[model samples]
Target chain A: MKILVCVSKTPDTTSKVAFTDGNTKFDEAGVQWIINPYDEWYSLVRAIELKEKDASVVIHMVTVGGADTEPIIRKALALGGDEAIRVNSDSTDSYYIAAQIAEIAKQGGYDLIFTGKETLDYNGSSIGGMVAELTDAPYISLATKFDLEGTTATVTREIEGGEEVAEVALPAVVSCQKGMAEQRIPNMRGIMAARTKPLKVTEPVAADALTAIVNFELPPAKAGVKLVDAENVEELVRLLHEEAKAI
Target chain B: MSVLVFIDHADGHVKKSSLEALTYGAKVAAQLGTSAEGLLLGTVTEDLAALGKYGVTKIHQAANEALNNLDTQVYAAAIAEAVTASGATVIIFSHTPTGKAVAARVSAKLKAGLVTGACALPDTSNGFVVKKGVFSGKAFANVSINTAVKIISLNPNSYMTVAGEGTAAVAPLAISAGAAKVKVTAVNKVSGDVPLTEADIVVSGGRGLKGPENWGILLDLAKVLGAATACSRPVGDAHWRPHHEHVGQTGVQVAPNLYIAVGISGAIQHLAGVNRSKIIVVINKDPEAPFFKAADYGIVGDAFEVLPKLTEAIKKMKASA
Candidate 1:
């Protein structure tokens, strides 16, 4: 079995969002880049789980980013991916990114494709579905748990009010969410082996750019707190009614 | 051309988000020089025609025993058929779970361009462009759908539900519904009045509340406000609250009109899930807690001492009003 996993380079969770070059684009300066938490934890772990279940299964990881993103890609390799592919494209638009990943999946003929339910940065969650369509493969998003026995895979996912159990045949795409697996940290041996792991760099496939970001601005900072003094219970009630108006 | 909006429900009752979608679709159809129609699947106990007051001119339904249960494959096929047969140029669905699954499938089947998690009406000026969240809730992306038929899945709580005096003409579309291959033998419903994700107002507490027994104060405030109850990720993990009540990066992502965070330090993970909220009220004793930096309103007081008093005031206001 051949599986392909999609990863994205996003700002570390703690980075303060800012823009550069006169605020026209997101300022990448001094920002620590990491595998999008969702894709790293859920999608990568589930892919490793599949490889563990079957010895012949080969797990491959790929990302669409600039040359600088190679380190994050290597970290994913250290986490257990057998091989890696990097499409040298730094485009942030979902359609352009999807086009690049879709071209790779089409060329590779992967039996299964895995991506996080959505990336922390481009919360679109639309790419995997689009890639599935581009590949003419069935798509299942937000699977919490999955098992493969034969040609078909049964996936259990959480919905708005309840859970759903679905089954689809092979040669499909599935997006992973929280309950798929816990986040994995690469150890020393895996990191050393990742240095020699097959990391392939390829030119991006030409595709139509569907959308682009016009500008990015930080969310407005909030004001200071209105402390009512913990001991003054009456003052707190007065504040709630007069100031908050929510009560 | 007509725009069809799917009304999602649980146990035969329409959800608030569905109504918001109806309002959004109606406005979109009017903008596109078309009629706004609605499609009600599953069994709903509410009068369908009355819902038309929100802007729908007609409500087409397929209320079957099997339809009452959510089967994405069956739903996708049914809605796709409806769109094709009804001559629907634009089909809208709330980005809720059922709608998410069905929208993608129907778009693929109908060969339509789908833009999910749309925060507002399409930019219908030069062409059809939908603004959607790109980096989770961090940034916005405008996607242009240059297709004849367009599919849009609106994000929950983004569009306000506008009500006007419009009575809907009810019609049951005669279409064959597919069978659900997956069967649900039983559903163990979570014991809670307000679903954490769907609530317009969410009242969540963290370790600041002290312990599980002290949760009543939080619950009382939430109940008085008609708000859903949630907890910080740590509190939920600590078993102070049920897992379903967890709201943060690893838990549910919500964009309610109002989010009330009590005792939480406003961790980045928690803020990512709820930063899109229209208004935020943070009540934490620590004046320097990170949550204060994002709150529209911040109250510094011991929750045990403040929350109960706030609940009592709300109860009094509700009773007098």
Candidate 2:
């Protein structure tokens, strides 16, 4: 089974988020990048577990970004991906990125595709569905559990207030989240093996970015907290009702 | 050129988020000098005409049972057909799970620009620019859509639902919902009065609560406030609470009106999920807890000592009101 796992680089969760260039671009000056947690901790790890069960499974990691994204992709390779494909583009538009991945999926003819539920930077949960639509495959989002049997895949996904179990034929797209797999760290052996893994870079296919970033603005800073004494519980309630109007 | 809003429903009732979407769509239509209409794919028990009070002028119904269970591909196809037939230049969704599942698919099929988790109406004064939360609500981005056909999925609770006096004309839409590729086998619903995503107020607990045995106080507080109960990652990880109750960057992200955290330290991951909330109150025994930095109200006191009193006070306040 050939599985294509789409990965993206995002600022580390602890990094202070800021914008640059008249707020049209995210400031990368002091930002530390990591493989998006959902992609690394869930989607890619689950594929590795599936590979552990079947020796025939080959996991290929694909990322859409510039060269700065290589280290993150290489880390994913150390985690267990057999090969890596980088679409040389830095477009942040969801459609542009999905179109790039869809092109790679079409050429690879993989049986399964995996992506994180959404990227940490943009929080746009649109790529998996767009790729599924572009490739004419069934797409499942917010998958918490996934199991494969022969050519059929069973997925447990989160809905509004509950979970739903669904089954789809092979060659489907699954956007994974927590509960799908546990986080795994790359060992020295895996890290060394990743150094020898084939890293392929391809130019991005011609695709129009449907949307453009106009500007970014940070959320207003919080007014200093109102410290309520432990004895004055009623005052807190009064403040919530009268001052904050939250209750 | 018209605006078509997708009315998401379950068990024959329209969702609260969809109402917000309807109002948002109506306002966008008004901005563009066109009428706003609604499309309901499944059978609903609610009066379709009454939804016009949310500002829709017409309601299109596709009363199909298959459409009720959220098949993304089928729903996208049905919505695409509705868009084409209605000559809608813009589409609106609620940014709920159902909307997240299908909005991008329709955008892909129709080659329209799509923006999810939009926090405001489009700034049509210049071009079709939509403002949305980026970096998990740490910041906002104004995105411009260049496509002629545009889709916006409004984040729940972001827009107020304005109701006026009017009734919509319900029309039966003719379209095939197509075969569902993914077959749902079972649905396990979490029984709760308020789903965390739609709850106006949320009361959450953390590791400082000691264990699951002490959850009663938190539940009592939630019950009094009519709020949903959630948990920090550590609590969910320890299975003291179900994983569904976990709210963080990796878990469920909620933007409730009021979020009260008991014992949580307000880690960045946890804050990412809930920083969008209108108001935040942090209760922690440790005065140095990081959650106090982000909180609008903070009480440095033991949960065991503070919770019962706060719950009783809120309960009394509610009873008297």
Candidate 3:
């Protein structure tokens, strides 16, 4: 089985968010980049687990970014991906990114495709469905559990207020979320091997972005907290009802 | 040249987020000087005509039983067809699980610019620009949709649901749902009066609660306040709470009117999921807990001592009111 796992580089969760160049570009200075937690902890780890179970299974990691994303892709390789493909483009538009990934998936002809439910940066949970549409493949989003037997895959995905168990044949796209797999750390030997693994860079296919970023604005800062004495629980309740009007 | 809103429903009732989307779509239609319409794929028991009070002039339904359960591909195809037939240049969705699954496919099919997590209406003054939360609500981005056809999925609780007096004309939309490739076998639903995403008030516990056995105190507080229960990532990871109740960067993000954090040291990830709340109250024994910075109110006290008193006080306040 050949599985293609989509990964992306995002600012570490703890990094302070800021924009530069008139808010048209993210200020990357002093920002620590890492593999998106959803991609690293869930989607890629699940693929590694599948590869560990089946000796013939090959896991390939694909990412769309500029040269700065190489380090993150190498980290994914250390986590058990056999090969890596980098599309040389830094477009943040969801459609443009999905189109590029779809192009790779079409060429790879993989039996299964995996992506995080959404990237940490954009929070646009749209890529997996767009890739599925572009490739004419079955799609499932927010998958919490996945199992494979023969050619069929059973997935448990989160719905509105519940979970739904569904089945689809191979050659499908599934976007994974938490509970799909546990986090894995790369060992010294794996890290050494990842340095020598094949990292193929490919130019992006010509695709027009449907959307563009006009500018970014910071969220309004909160006013200082009103410290209420724990002994005066009634005051807190009263404040909620009167001052905040939250209850 | 109309604004079409996708009305998402479950168990025959329209979802609250969809109602907000309908109102938003109506306002957007007014901005564009066009009419607002609603498109429903599944069979529903609600009075469709009464939804006009949300500003929709008409409700177009396909009325297919297969559409009841969410099939992303089938729904996308049906919606694309509806958009083409109705000549709707603007499409609106609620950004719920159903909308998340279907909207992107529809956008891809129609070659439209799709914006998810939209927090405000589009600015049509110069060009079509929509403001949305990025970096998990840490910041906002104004996105320009250059495509002729545009799709916007409104984040829950971001827009107000305004209902006036009017009845919409219910019309039958001729659209055939395609065969579903993904077959659903079973469903497991969380049994609760209020779903966390739709809750007006959310009471969340964290690792400081210590164990799952000690969850009763938190539950008591939620019960009195008529709020939904949530937990931090650590609490969910430790199995103190179900994964569905976990609210964080990777977990379910909620923007309720009020969020009360109990025992949780607010991590940046935890804040990402909840910073959108209208008001936040943090209760922790550690005065240095980071959540206090983002909270509207703070109480430096242990959960064991503070929660029961708060619950009792709220109960008494409610009884008196």
Indicate which candidate wins on TM-score.
2
Compose the digit string of candidate 1's lDDT tens values, residues A157-215. 77665566777778888888877887889999999999999989999888755454544
Task: Give the least accurate 10-residue stretch of model 2 chain B, judged by summed lDDT.
Answer: B64-73
Highest DockQ: which candidate?
A: 2
Superposition error at A7 for model 2 (Å): 0.3
Which residue pairs collide in model 1, if any?
Answer: A121-B135, A122-B134, A122-B135, A123-B134, A123-B135, A123-B136
Off by over 4 Å in 3: none
In the range A1-247, model 3's lDDT, one tens digit per residue, is 9999999999988888999998899899999999998889999999999988998999999999999999999999998889999999989999999999999999999999999999888899999989988998888999999999988999999887779999998889999999999988999989999999999999999998999999999988788999999899999999999999987
lDDT (Cα, tens digit) per residue for candidate 3, span B1-321: 999999999888999999999999999999999999999998988899999999999999999888887777888889988998889999999888888888998888888999999999999998899999999889999999999999999999999899999999999988866788889899887876588888889999999999999999999999998899999999988888888999999899999999999998999999999999999999999999999999999999989999999999999989998
Q: Tens digit of lDDT per residue, candidate 2, span B1-321? A: 999999999878999999999999999999999999999998999899999999999999998887777778888889989998899999999988888989999999998999899999999999999999999999999999999999999999899889998999999998876798899999998875588899999999999999999999999999989999999999999999999999999999999989999999999999999999999999999999999999999899999999999999998998899
How does model 2 fare in lDDT?
Answer: 0.94
Clashing pairs in 2: none
Q: Order the candidates by DockQ, highest first — what do you get? A: 2, 3, 1
Best-to-worst ranking by TM-score: 2, 3, 1
Clashes per candidate (backbone, < 3 Å): 6, 0, 0
Q: Lowest-lDDT window of 10 residues in candidate 1 chain B?
A: B181-190
Docking class of 1: acceptable
lDDT of 3 at A238: 96
State the lDDT of candidate 1 residue by residue for B142-224, as single tens digits.
66776788888998999988998868998887658656654444454565577766888899989998889889888888888
